[model samples]
Target: MSLPEPRDPSGPYRISVVCLGNICRSPMAEKVLTGELDRAGLSGAVEVASSGTGGWHIGSGMDSRAAALLRAHGYPTDHAARRFDPAHLAEHDLILAMDHANLDDLRRLARERADIGDRLRLFRTFAPDAGPSPEVPDPYYGGEHGFTTVLDMVHAAAKGLTAELAARYGSAL
Candidate 1:
């Protein structure tokens, strides 16, 4: 799908990645996407952040497994968990949910602002080979292998999204 135009044309495009809790999938996708944007030379033209639909992990760091996997892959591991604020609908150019549940939460919060509908999408939708199911499965309750799997999925989606951003904004960069 085509990206929505920046809400504020002169400012960097803002993106918020969200999941059930800020400690896992969303933060992983956030850091991975940030790195991909940097690699694509669009880092300065875009801003990335992450939050959760639920408050369970609010104020905590990213899940240990997720942090370790990102560190091993050379991605930064600094993150402070926070809940997704409905006000973000006005602030972000795009809001990506890690799974359908989080998407539903975001959708409910956004019901009052119908104009922002185009900004919402599943994080995996950007992955070229994501197939029919685009949800990024939560790795919180699983073993190390689950984190590894999530990282791979995030990396693929990040690369695809970066390419699209570069195509649209590369000239300015």
Candidate 2:
């Protein structure tokens, strides 16, 4: 199925990127998407936030490797870890899960909401080169290269997502 239409074209199109631990993938995705949105000149019209399916790192800062990778690539590195709340379904236009497991977690959490299926999606769905793998791998325990790899994946998806949003709400931007 296709993505749902933007709910509030005139207002901010909110998005939430979710991963297993907020300290890693999701925060990186959030910064990349936000930076891409800002570069596309939709900074004020689109807002991107991030959280985790688990609450282990809630209130913690992003992993040093992630923050370094983002800053090295000219993206924002300011973010704190948070748990993905079910209430985010109401506040965000889209909720992108980094992996299928977390996507499943979000789907189960969103079971009570009628439009859950419409807003929830895999983050890598937007990446043209994402290929058969749809999940953004967790780099928490990996070496430095892993963080850079995640950054590359997030960057591609962020650009694609920005284009999609720009097409839908270019006038507002």
Candidate 3:
């Protein structure tokens, strides 16, 4: 289960965002990040997707609030919730967990894939001044404010992540 480095620099840089349920945080991150990359003119160079650590919401649509928030921000809201598969380690260049619990779950799923350490990271790790809290809080049970807050956090981190990707694969892109 060894997580390999970006297999081919000339190929698309794959990214997978994960959370407890694919409907909220993960889908928002996915759409926001994809929008950021497209705005950066790096959409062709990057492949962004998301999934949940659990299977409960598999095949469902993104949470309504989450979809609405993304729509308001001019981001796409077309995403089908899916559970993260172990095989994703071999497919994606990076796996971003929205919170510590999801991060831990991904790591546990990695099992003996010791080499995956470099590729497994918290989504907020890319945010500027993220402080000690590296989570993109779940907004499903909260009010509209919660969804907006998650959007802000996701937008900030998506910008950072896009910049990092552009720097790393600019020429190839």
Best by lDDT: 1
* lDDT (CA) per prediction: 0.92, 0.87, 0.87
Candidate that beats the other on lDDT, 1 or 2, i.e. the better one: 1
Error (Å) of candidate 3 at residue 45 is 0.7
- Give per-candidate clash totals: 0, 0, 0
State the lDDT of candidate 1 residue by residue for 51-152, as single tens digits. 999998889998989998899989899999999988888999999999889899999999889789689999999999999999999988999999999998
As for lDDT, the candidate ahead, 1 or 3, is 1
Candidate order by lDDT, decreasing, is 1, 3, 2
Clashes of 2: 0
Q: What CA RMSD would you report for each candidate?
A: 0.9, 1.4, 2.7
Worst ten-residue run, lDDT, model 1? 164-173
Candidate 1 runs further than 4 Å off? none
What lDDT tens digits, residue by residue, belong to model 2 across residues 64-148? 9998888888877787788988888888888999999999999999888887657998999898898988789999899999998
TM-score versus the correct structure, for each prediction: 0.97, 0.94, 0.94
